[model samples]
Target: MARIELSGIQKRWGKVVGVRDVDIEIADEEFVVFLGPSGCGKTTTMRMIAGLEEPTEGEVIMDGEVMNDIDARDRDVAMVFQGYALYPNMTIYENIRFPLRMREVPKGEQDALVRRAAEMTELTDYLDRKPSALSGGQRQRAALARAIVRQPQVFLMDEPLSNLDAKLRQAMRVQIKHIQRQLKVTTVYVTHDQIEAMTLADRIVIMEGGAIQQIGTPDDIYNDPANTFVAGFIGSPPMNLVEGAIDAGTFTAQGIEVTGLPAALSGNVVLGFRPEDCTVGGNTPHLKGSVFGVEPTGDLTYLTIKVGGQQIEVKADRAFRAELDTEITVTFDPARICLFDAKSGERLR
Candidate 1:
């Protein structure tokens, strides 16, 4: 029963705010991810939950109890940090056993617990090695093994994969997911990587400038973003947005025109559509532009076109080829298109 609740949480350093009033309910055994760019206060929010940073207002509740004043060490939550945070001089065996020893698990039970965690992280063979002898991935695995030994009610991971290379990060992501599923511990992971959040989270909390922008599953965040910022930030190439105006159901801007807009929607607006939702070379296209560039990424060829003097990306078939600076027409699925108010960047519908 490790359900977590954050009610009206805020963090402020003097007059400058780090995080706004954040309210969320995390179900028992649920995996929730906090995702945002640097200085967006994602880390601060995690720290508040871990009892490391005191919230300026509101409560951090674990299960049904308020934990705002509980000492971090006594909170029974295990945190895995980005830097590994392993003891350099200690062997992997000693590192994994440290937590159990601190909590004074009986000496007779410590060896089996250490070996089990080591095996789970595939570090059993390297248990005798000091941190200096292990590669970055191995060291990180040792860090995770250490956390596994704690048997905490919740797992708080702060970009634990950020230190590894791309390939290692991918492998570790699989391992971490497997471990979390096996344990069924309520988890809160923080990262700037959208891919990580999309792959691992049961739900994602997107934050910007110290405030939450949206909270939803990966599909919801990708296919139904709440606003322009979310639409612009999630994808590898992101969604295409054009500044334009709609009047009498016709949306018009320089080098672009789209029709069939709702009669009631008339004003300055930002039209948006995903790169993959667009089909190139349509006769009655919604957008027309000259090809600006072409990126061939093996499976798919990404085409960049100049629309309304703005570069927009289109995901074309890998075999789909277009000459540079050549004209191309694009049509978007109406159900997949998005509209935003020009002033607030909020969704119009």
Candidate 2:
């Protein structure tokens, strides 16, 4: 029943603001992720939630109680850090059981609890091994196991998979999601990886420049970005943005032109569309360009076309191929295109 709410949260270091007016309501047992690039205040927001850093304004409420003054240890939250922060001197069993031991759970009860968490993490066999004896993934699992033993009301994980290799990271993501679902404790995960945010979050809080840009489910964030920054940051190849101006119903840029705009959108504007939304050809609305770069991902081929002076990326089928400097024609789905105010970066529609 750990429903968390961050109300008008802001953090500052004198004149340097770390986070600004961020607000989020996390439903009980829901998984939420704070996602952004480096120095974007994701971790700072998490730290404030954990009570490690004080918010210059607003409240950190859990289950309707304001936790602004509550010490971190007293907040009944478990945190898993990126570093794994395991006790090298202690055996896996001892490390996992440390929290229970600290809280003085009965000796008879400790064994079952410790063994259960270890078994849940698939570390039952390695309980006797010390931290150094385990691999990186195992160590991370050990850290997670330790958190599990706490049975805390909230779970705060800060880039728990960043330390692992790509394969291991994927595995850990599955493991983490599985554990979170099974436990059903309110969880907050912080990471810069958009894929992690997309695949793991029930709702994502996207931040930039110390302020929240948008918050929504993965599909919402992907399909309906709030602004140019979000559209540019959320995708694999990201959304292609070209600075242009809409005169009457027509949009004109260095290398692209689009008409049929909603209303009489005039003045400076930016156009955005996903690589996947644009096709190689065979559509009504088409733009011609030259192939500047082609990337084959085995599953799909990505073609970078120099549309006018702007480089527009178009996702093509795996069979698609084009040589550099070859003339190409790409069609954009007008329904999928986004328009933004060029000066403000806010979505126009």
Candidate 3:
């Protein structure tokens, strides 16, 4: 295993910056995920580390050695592409053995290696079948097996499960996590799916517009986002952001008043809170609003309430699928509310 480090990393295409002045240290045998929306440079950063893309600036260091000058094949890393990219004509055995064959391993060793990989991935029963004969999940496993067979020091995966169905994707997430933990290889994964990042990473790197936004564990990014963008980006149904001004000790939205804001906040600011932080039935309410819609998914209910001309989503455990046009009373817990500068979208105390 090897620790990977990227220092002052920047990538540019002509005048467009794909990533800027980023520094990250990934410990040996740790799984790190790069997460963001599309075109945010998560993929770019992963590719640079994989030796597929040369960074415009910065260094890729591994195990105390600078890796910028090394060839892709010499980097001691394996990559699983987003599309699976299996050779259509090759059988599962052939595909998994391709890398070993490229390096001209003896036939007996290649057979041993391929057998071991197939056994680990549970693809031994279908070793003779080509890619066209395998299910999507099976194909994905084949791709992973190919990477695992190499025993690389680092594993780089670029949205490897993005194409699977919902159920399959969920299953694969657990499978991949289990495999990574068992192998203990340092891994760098890039994906736009927040759930995947949160579920798999030892730590997450949140990025946007070619820049790193925040890097922390799943709980850290979920409970304490660095800014408004991260606050909105990290959660399901997202954190509610209301445009309002703080006056005296209360926050005023439309004509309604919300009390108990932290003392330092004043003037134009945005109040942010997760849906779970708001309560549906409360005695002393912070704001009164109408329930615009309710989505019940058996285990949880999401209510979208109209507050001050904006819709705020609230997550609750009880099934409260109230009608769309119904008026609902809501309350915000001041201590749970996050404050951000309205103009800059920066979080405030």
Task: Give the lDDT of residue 198 in candidate 2.
Answer: 99
**lDDT tens readout by residue for model 3, 199-224:** 99999999999999999999999988
The collision pairs in model 1 are none
In model 2, the number of clashes is 1
State residue 143's C-alpha deviation in candidate 3, in Å.
0.3
lDDT of 1 at 188: 95
lDDT of 1 by residue, 280-342 (tens): 877788888899999999999999999766898999999988899898898888788888899
Worst 10 residues of 3 by lDDT: 255-264
Model 1 reaches what TM-score against the true structure?
0.98
Q: lDDT tens string, model 2, 15-37?
A: 99999999999999999999999
lDDT values, one for every candidate: 0.92, 0.92, 0.89
TM for every model, in the order presented, reads 0.98, 0.97, 0.96
